[model samples]
Target chain A: MSRQTDSQSTTKTRPVPPTLSVITEGSPLSFVNPDGTLTADGEAHGIDIELTRGLYREMLLARTLDREALSLQRQGELNLWLMCLGQEAAQIGSVAALLPSDMIFPSYREHAVALYRGVTPAELLVQWRGLAHSGWDPRKYNLQMAALVLGTHTLHATGYAVGARMEQTDEVVAAYFGDGATSQGDVNEAFNWASAGSLPVLFICQNNQWAISTPTSVQSGGQIFRRAAAFGMPTWFVDGNDVLAVHAATTAAAAHIRLNGGPALIEAETYRMAGHSSSDDPTRYRSDEELESWARRDPLTRIEKLLRLMETPESFFAELDESAERLGAEVRDACRNLEPTELADLFGNVYAEPHDSLEAERRSYQESARALAGVNR
Target chain B: MSTMSLVGALNAGLRKSMADDDRVILMGEDIGTLGGVFRVTAGLREEFGADRVVDTPLAESGIVGTAIGLALRGYRPVCEIQFDGFVYPAFDQIVSQLAKFRARSGGRVSLPIVIRIPVGGGIGAVEHHSESNESYFAHTAGLRVVSCATPDDAFHMIQQAIQSDDPVIFYEPKRRYWDKGEVLDQSDRNLHEARVLREGSDCTLVAHGPTVATALAAALAAAEDGFSVGVVDLRTISPLDLSTLEEQTMTSGRVVVVHEASTFLGIGAEIAAAISESCFYSLRSPVLRVGAFNMPYPPAKVEDAFLPSVDRVLAAVDHAMNY
Candidate 1:
């Protein structure tokens, strides 16, 4: 293996793009307008309306869950909560376009993606509540556990995609990360491996502009989508606030990845209207005026306007509102009814086989706790 | 029966495994055309086309990361990490991803990836070259760590590790790669069990990897002095064969652990603690450990002094006997 092969290509440098663009421009993909109305031509399309409605419903459900989770945190129930407040369109739309056969490796902030994949809202809450690692089974939904580490999951997703190619499975893998993760070494390594191996993976960067206090300009000096082109991957950018645009771009990119046995990139250029999480106070870093500007392009409001302009019956809007209320109430009930998990479960699943050392440690802890309880009694 | 060195046995085992299963593929730096730095993967690239034996870039993370993907794709990828010290860059992939994938998938996916690394000291290697870091992988959940001390063990264990559905971290003794022994045509051996290389009743000397050969040599040296010492080779490091250990220690009534890694938080520390808990009453003397001191591996000239040689094992055994 030490012999240098002339067949290996020397590293080549490519031109970088100044700005991101893919499905945001004028096209049959645009279902909603900036004025919150469906264009005259948009009203004629039935698939666009249905997909927009689905995105709106999922977003509403996610928002309600977000609110309830925040309440739980404030009430001293959860250890922490990372709210997916304003990037619901990027999550829901991209996930909706993915076939069930495709595997998704998500960062911790993908509440809407988890919901779309049918993970019970309560299950997602339990993890933040400090009761479990991840609430749902990954196999049942073809989703891996939410990785808390920033860009590490990207490498895992790339490895899995390579595995898929070796197995000759036509399935694609999607790894979701934020713009802030672009700075991590693992993300760049993932790009290199996926490109070198030609793994079937879709790298979706939810460019919500801010990673905590750090802005996108600080995270990357150039466009994130163009970063993929240098790796020989086809890249796409979507107005992540627009559900229809996101769906179109992700669907197209995913198809390209599946057909070409190589990685593709999708930069969902969205904005976070709310603070990063309940623990964060964006007032310290961002201006209210800037927040309001992005909120004006609210994904839900845009789609709702389009539905109304399509002359979709008032009954449809009423049903959706009612369903949102039901979902909110259901989340509330589930949170209130969540049972406390055993402390032993933490050590139990750590290893598949019984580890005598861990077991001994657990027993010692139990004994100490019992002794303290006995003394108190 | 055929006599072969540890490296030669590993090569034969790999060839047999590749011949047995088309899904078994080898990937690592210098594993293909160069047959690895130690020639453990010698002739594999020529026999099995480049597809089955891949020469990866000089990226350890990439090798392990891609192996995970290859495993997901239903290919049994055996990754070589070149050296024990070089495995840190891939620690995230092995511990975080490789070890957790099967459990994270909730049994929906099984990762049959094997990572082989040349470990331990005594060949006068430089820094970041000689390390017994099996404890790190053994402590991690969803991984099986094992080391072979003899040619016969190497011949059998490699095939056993490949057949396992779980991920296995296979540590090869780089220093003992050329040490030869007679390897039988058949090895109907259990990979999870410990082997009693040299039996005695006075005290037991436990070791694995390069240290196992050293402990065996010490046992031989002890026999000349009319001292009866039991020598046990711990094949499985993760799920340690404590059953055999407890049985041997109870009969021997004393024990000494040996390894090349720093003593603190090393495999010896874990084994000593486990033995104390399990065979507390059976112990005639406190469990003693003979391992590298808690420090960075010394320079090549001082490596022979840093590693646990037969003299160090005998010294530890003498100290235990005095107690």
Candidate 2:
């Protein structure tokens, strides 16, 4: 395996900023200057006013929904909440590029993607409220549940894509994870399986620069996309804050994959504007300068800046804000109103077939309840 | 309808399952061309087409992980983990993801996957090749665990496990793979029911998987010694055949449990605990258990000392009877 990394010395020597976000315009790909402004040529290619306005509305709503969930957790209404403060552009742009029939395996914290896919704010926040493990039916939305384990979902995405190929369907699969997960063996194994089998799976890597508190360089050795490329797959490194770039890259990647051109990797350079979760405090491990630098290049801020250039209506902005407020209110109401899971639910569905032990447990529970309530079974 | 070995019965069962449902697909390492190291999946790739019988990468986690995805797409994927000791690589996927998916999804979706693993020892194989790790999966909430001590069970239970909509850990007694048994033309038993292998009035010996043969042999030996020793094969380890276990053990008034896994938290422990609670009044003894010590599976040369032999089971049985 060490020999397999023939370019290791070369690859390891080149310091590709683990969270570098470079924007390119036309042929030869001129970079967007450090000021975070895109070239006119890049803007003209796919940045339509409607798309910009749509991305802005979705991004703002995602933030509002995230804020409400965070408040709920703090208010002791919800057990815990993970804020998807940054990487909205990466999640929104990439997921917006896919058809609903195509499957998605998300490594938790893709709140923007879930919102874009019409996973209602109520359903999305229900899990964080500790009422249900998942609120919506994955099949109904064509999205699997948000997997909390690091890189495990990538294998599922590859397998699903392989099955689609086996059935001769042109359906594609998308897997989303962070840079820290790239170091995991399961992700590497998924790359091999997806490439060797020529499966139509899209690897969406949100390079949030931090896997919790660990820096990408400290966690990952070489370039993430390059790792996938070594496995005989195409690779794309994109500016995740640039919604147009992510959308264009993912759209093309999805096209190539649906055509059965094997798997493709998209390393979306993004940042976690908030702490890892509600329990985390970014002030400890990270420098203020770095946080300020990335915050200035925040995905929502960048998208808002782009939308402002289009002279988007105040009415449009006002309507989105109103909708976001309504979404926040609706989610809070749903979480509070959710019925507690019945005691029977614990013993039910352990197996599709009936089992004696679970039945006994159920009987024992009912009997205990009966004894408490002065009844008989 | 015909006599067959456990592995042969498994191959036939897999063939039948795939034929019955187009969604039934087999995936494993070396399962395609190499026919698996044990050849339990022999000729499946050719007959079912390479598309259906996929030869997966050498990674165990990848095999089970991908199978979960296939199941999500409505394909009843049956994954064959090559060996017992190597299954830890897939432990996270099996317990956290595969086992919990249906429950996490609020029952809207199910991962109907059958993970067929050839388990147990006495094969004189090297380290990591022989282990009884069924207890790890049996302890998990969302997964069903079953083991076959006979070829007939290998045939019917494999099919039954494939048809189940929950993730099932199917343990095949590797040592008994070559032991022939008559598979009836029909199966009238449920997938989770325990079978009474022998009848007795004095004591009942509870065993599962590879230990069932040892328990049966021990029971026979006890009978020759003027003792009436019954045997119960616990087909399903997770949702244990508790009713059958209660009936037999309570009737006999004495019980001994046997397994190859560590005695501390193994299925033997589970059985003893359950019987101690349910058959407390009827019990004549303190539910003795004969199993391996609480340690990793030793090298093959010394496995005889580690595994519960017929004599060891008899020793436990005599202890129970005397108590």
Candidate 3:
């Protein structure tokens, strides 16, 4: 998991600007196409069949868990769930490419990375189920609590990289955000900060076409990756549906950062196949034609087509299907079995230091609760 | 012991803190090389190096936002917001992110970050240079807000805040930065406790930061007028050491709270409400408040009339005593 390079070439001491031609080119760098074939760039990128298969399995598990959580929301078992339905490759691929010790500050919708990092179904569901403000301890997983305020976490990731560099650590910090997040000032400042400092950070923009209902065209003036160029960061525009492309790009970017080549931005162009959240109705603003067009270029379907073309055994698919079913059942039970939070628990964690005012408030609340209990009983 | 100005004392405190712990770093605009606009961070960059005392990009949100990240990585970051009025740009990061991270993480995360804001109006600076917005952070649940009035308090309190595990909004009275006083080798009081600067029997004058001096001056004026008025410096704003406030209120039987912030829903309102709740029967008169009128901080030339002055404090004390 540690990408600690022994030494770098003297030329690598200074940051190497990204390939301008590739970034300026409008088309996304697609590795695996829908026709069960690799594109020219994909051929040059060279797919690791074994790693691709593992990535596909992770995506399948994510897809299965995503479907189950959405069902739980619909059944009123959970309060809300944001689906990682179509951006599986973007999430799984980018997370897998980074070192396990690399800290990640993710936006609320990075479910696949959370699961991959060993955050349990119960831990992930507690927040969505209205049980807790946060589910898992970030220190345990090196993953921060989901930042609901858009684009704020990018600065966190950049600052973390700065601190890590000051500590002389080789770990590259990463942030997962969306197309809309690129428009935020904090995110732009982060780009400039990381670039100016030559800090090790990988900004992964999962450009899922729609920020709720606003399409990428309306969300940004130009391609999201091009925005990074303005800050002198290495930029890559990759097919988010192609897991292999994301893995390659991210792995390369992480290496460059480790080699003191500074921060990099990768825009993984994918589509959000589901409504923004359980509460959102995307059909109101988008067309069925657009949805149908994206469904054909689905992240899961292309990976499956490639695996089938490679004659990956039927047993692998069969075993994975069994695992997915098991996962669905386990998540359903976990969501239902989460412990309810108490009124007193809210007061306990406001500050690490002792606070007299909060304690007083808690005591008053306890008395009121007791009075209410006496009346009800 | 050394006699120094508030600016010099703060610089010494920060130097001591950074020297004591390698993790303590300072980040803000003009803090590095420039030594801050008020020279509070003077000579720190040369001693601590560029990495430790970072001059950040001119983005308030970025300064606070990144400081939170640095705190997460086990660094104690003290961010200097250039001015009180300039803090709004970083308001969301301070209020929504830095303040809430601990509770949001269920106490797993502790952001030992200090936001040093030079606050209040008096210097006759341009618009947006003077403000007393401590009420905003004080009203928020997760933050600890404190202000320093004298040189000694500025020296000790800045060091204490850096060591605090909770995120602290540290307000330095801008107008009082150059006021000189003796700073002790170490403090004998808790960071959040209110101290009775002067004792009297007739009435109590409560204030913090810049207003503490005015309250003390008013207390002296009241003594000359044959009225014994006490002065209490409320160093802490949030957890508000209500016991001391209540004790003073009961002993004097009358109370007057003053500050540079607007009286409308300011810290005075909370103190008045708390006093009423705890010691209403002991009070000989209703708790009165003296602060700026409810309006945007006026132009610099007129701030002297707008800010709580010695006269304003004496008027409140008089009102409380006569009532």
Candidate 4:
């Protein structure tokens, strides 16, 4: 393939800011200072504390689920499980900002988002457990099914937003992807369509710093938020590790998108403290020191510290942990006791009406299997 | 009601679709002011405005990715890939998301997205411009892959592809874009069924897209000899329309499959397998395929020789009949 050297060289020579200046310019979006003290302005905001506490509980719950799912995979229960160990804050905080009417298109790692949308732990486990194709019906909850492709869902979300606007609906659509997805051509194409149509879409990028083994630097030249400005969408950068910051950023961004007809982007600066998936090993590409440094800024830990400083009751923490444990047990049992999938189920729902050839093939396969089992006798 | 080239017919079909449905939108690189490199989207921006007819950045994956988002929001997006070979950047979206969305959503979400790709060789284009990547999409479960061989089919099939609840990969044969044919005002034909373009009794020749024209030309050449040949245009690649193919092969007792893609794992392989299984006892000879060899599609200078031509189809038909 001939290298498109001119474009690459031009992009490289362009002087770009290191990150979004909005974070430094201070707005109502920040909850904690760089020194970890609660902002005096934030303490006066009652809803901010409640939302942060809720986010903390949910992130912890998500981490518990992640651990259990990984264990299940090791125990030969699931075929595979993509862990969102270090991404709970990004998922929970971003999802927490969604209105009931708003829709979310998530990439596969957004387990917390599904939970926030009311998808039961059992239902979510079915997909990785190999018992079901999708976790739940998208219509029942505004959350669309998880997409495994890196950046494809962005287009689907943009199309959905355009559709919503055509109907004059007030709903906004949010698409969640990772930093690595910024390298995908579809991600950029989505920006084009969303901007041109002025569709009501909130494009959230959870910049977890890696696309599997590839690092963020390899994916793009600089911050992904800058790409949004080029597409004519106002972009924001948030400390993804801080749930309060993530929630505020996403809420503000979604509000801007709903009030305006165009798209907005939020690049959550975060880290993936865990391996990309159960099958991945971070030791191959990253060092333990880097992982430990990110762990210190854990989203859950910061929220817990803030809650403690406020002298929140011990019962609050106790109840939250208890509930998380119960949720984990329920998920484990559901995964272990999953029923064997029937062969007929595969062909039953491929189309609205059964296709004639598919039905014939199904019947033939059933008859042959019955003969082999001696059931025909 | 009017006659137009396959490309013109497709443009008209898109115009009608956009006019009929406000949710219908056109998106791709250079599709706006430039009116598409091939002018397939000419006059669309002026007619529909920039909102409905969009010129996206040069990112194939992003175009398809956001189209998925737009589809979820209930908009019907028709995305253009510029060329077939350039589609790889967006393959993750097409195969993983677009192809699996309906099933993944348990039928709750139906992606009414149509991805238009200018496919097949003979365009004398650079690398990634001329390719036959239909087999990859056809093999994917949730997607429907179809191609148009004539202007009538182009005019009708493009609309049908847009209307289908499932995402459809609409492959436009670049080489046949300028080929003109009569397009009727109304089409009551089933989009999934294979059509018999010509009739014969000696052997059955199966092809689609660019090769459909080649198959017809070869059938004519064979008529000049003492051979009678039947031609079946496999418009839908995924569904295969094997029932129609079985009927044609059974009548002829010999089969030859032709395509612009490589022979290995190409559409021909599936058709050959289906014919052997469906009409095993009625077959007079083993099924033969005339296609590009297993290699990266050669550079444009040699693509004419690499593509399946009328001579290659005739040669394969001869080989099949000799049994």
lDDT of 1 by residue, A1-377 (tens): 10011101111111222222333333224545767665443354323555556667777777777887888788887888998888988998788777776899899999888877777877788778777667877767778788876888887788778667766888889999999998987888889878888888899999999999999888789888878767888887777887876776677777777777889888888897777887899999989998899988888888777667667888877886787788778777777778887675565655544555567778988899899989999
User: The CA-based lDDT of model 2 is what?
Assistant: 0.82
TM-score of each: 0.87, 0.93, 0.97, 0.85
1 against 3, candidate with superior lDDT: 3
lDDT of 3 by residue, B38-82 (tens): 998989999989999999999999999999999999999999999
Which candidate ranks first by lDDT, i.e. highest?
A: 3
Q: Write the per-residue lDDT of candidate 2 for residues A85-174, one digit (tens) a residue.
A: 888878887887777677899988988778777677667877887778888888767788898989999999988887898888888899
Off by over 4 Å in 1: A1-33, A37-47, A76-78, A344-348, A353-377, B19-23, B45-51, B72-75, B101-110, B278-284
Rank list by DockQ: 3, 2, 4, 1
User: lDDT (0-100) at residue A89 of candidate 2?
Assistant: 79
Model 4 chain B scores worst on lDDT over the 10 consecutive residues at B100-109
CAPRI docking class of candidate 4: acceptable
Q: Model 2: per-residue lDDT, tens digit, B1-323?
A: 99999889988988999999999999999999988889988988888899888888899999999998888888999998999988999999999999888778877778899998899889999889888998899889889999999999999999999999889999999999999989986799988899999877999988898989899889889999999999999898888888898899877998888888889988878888888888899988898888999888898889999999998988887888777
Residue A51 in candidate 1, Cα distance off native in Å: 3.1
Q: Per-prediction DockQ scores?
A: 0.32, 0.72, 0.84, 0.45
As a whole number from 0 to 100, the lDDT of residue A295 in candidate 4 is 84
After TM-score superposition, the amount by which residue A276's alpha carbon in candidate 4 deviates from its true location, in angstroms, is: 3.5
